[model samples]
Target: MASLLPYGDVDFSLRAMAGRAEGFGRNAIGGLHGPLYFVTTLADDGPGSLRAGCRRKEPLWIVFEVSGTIHLSSYLSVSSYKTIDGRGQSIKLTGKGLRLKECEHIIVCNLQFEGGRGHDVDGIQIKPNSRHIWIDRCSLRDYDDGLIDITRQSTDITVSRCYFAQHDKTMLIGADPSHIGDRCIRVTIHHCFFDGTRQRQPRLRFGKVHLYNNYTRNWGIYAVCASVESQIYSQCNIYEAGIKKKTFEFYTEKAADKAEQKSGTIISEGDMFLNGAQPCLQTQHTEGCNMFHPSEYYPIWTMEPPSHSFKDVLQICAGWQSVCRPAEISTNLD
Candidate 1:
């Protein structure tokens, strides 16, 4: 890979491993701990199949030996202490998606999720009470619901270096404004590519979210958003607005401000933009909402922006090539 930054900067690529004591380089280690579970075929066996490796009780590394697409007939339920590795294979999930419900210590990497539709069809649903989760280097698009929904007290999540394209309501951090459990959701989204996505990239609600070093291009409605007691720390991101697009409110504050209305807080610093006439426009809000710093959780995090342009780095590093597919596999085999 080409050098993306200046000589001495905390590598933007390292953002995936920011909070972990052991670094997560490139791929998120989903079930790569105790034992190795090689997915020998591309067959769907409901929750008993390879699609549901994260639901396994024992600690194991779920790896794909077979290279093909697994079209699900139902949602795949994930368990804790699992790593789903799709490297060295062309693994694609379609027609359905994964659900992480109250699970912990999970990682999902190097998979392609396409055309996921039907009910509850988020690419990845991080449900309530989940913790220590890392979702990295995946390709998510064309889902019926939001691509990713981190809701209901889900915390300690890191979503990085993935490619999100051709979608609307792309990523929803919280379930809804009324879901009170969403306040405990702490997530880190960094170095990802949001390309041609329609909206909600992503709509955050009631979470302490750290968003940094992401490259967004041609969003239909807005790039970043906050509502309902959410605290967003946005730093060092690049937005390339769509030409001929009327709205320039790259950063949006959802819901109207009122004296009795609950509000969300967004602290913006060190961001870049192109063709966005109204980037980072601070809107009206109710007072007394608490603001946060990324260092409160990630003490190693810095406010300093990247030394080089993300445009140059993202062209070669973002998406499936650098994030997923460590080795080439036969996509035509499926």
Candidate 2:
């Protein structure tokens, strides 16, 4: 087995940790007090496989020993108190993606999820009451249903520094219009690159989401969607529509089997629009929807007036990277 630049008792950097994301999942200490588990096989399941580590009842910091594609037969269900740290190797999951449900204290960092087939599939599905999760520096693309979906009352999640590309229905939050319990869902997304995705970057519903420092460009349908009583705070982001020229979309949905429909609220602060991306170009829906502001959660947050300078920064920083602990780079720096 290979080592990944000692990150335990040794002096190292935690910058790559998903918990480092500055959002609702900032408190997610994923397997920090657990033992290390090395994944030495590319098999879908069994010993030395990713499924084995993810299914463990106890906490574990799962690392990959070899770099290859893992063709999953079904959705890889992840349990609580686990950290799937892919820093030393390049691993990709195909055929199916991850299923995070009813778990907590999990961190998924620096991996690639692609080509997930089957209906209702997603690159990383955080569904059904899961909380305290952080997904960082991941590259998700070409999923059948969505690249990432956080629905069904999940909260305290942060998806930062990830890349999305070449997919329709890129992301969905709060899938169920009838599930009114989704109002408790809270997520923070920052430093992500939504590149040429079709729609749902993401189509949100009933969740209070904080999106900052993201680069959303070349959207097919629309860049961002606010639907069904969601409160979205889009700060310091960049939106560049390719041919659509539409940035925001407002969708109405009836909740809890009610006949009356209501849309969500959006507070766009310091966002840059390019390539004829119209900020007011939304569906024929009524405005003045009420929402909780990001200042209600944290009085202060990082926000800069959006600019084209963000394009280069997001393209370089967002997505999976070959990140080793600082112990490996300290010597070279000196």
Best by TM-score: 2
Query: What is candidate 2's lDDT per residue for 11-60, written digit by digit as tens?
Result: 25433353454678877878766777889999999999999999999988
Off by over 4 Å in 1: 1-32, 46-49, 243-259, 283-287, 302-309, 322-334
lDDT of 2 at 261: 90
Worst 10 residues of 2 by lDDT: 2-11
| Candidate 2 Cα outliers beyond 4 Å, as residue runs | 1-11, 14-18, 257-259, 281-289, 299-303, 325-334
lDDT of 1 by residue, 1-334 (tens): 4434311221222222222422112223344445667687788874335865656688766777678789888888888777776666778899889888878778776788999988678888889788888876788999999898888888878887789998989998877755767778888887788989988777887778887777888888777777777787778887778852422222233333323455576776777766752454455532455687766555454234543454667655555542232332233112
In terms of TM-score, how similar is model 2 to the real structure? 0.90
Q: TM-score for every candidate vs. truth?
A: 0.82, 0.90
Q: In angstroms, how far off is 146's CA in candidate 1?
A: 1.0
Candidate lDDT scores, in order, read 0.69, 0.82
Worst 10 residues of 1 by lDDT: 6-15
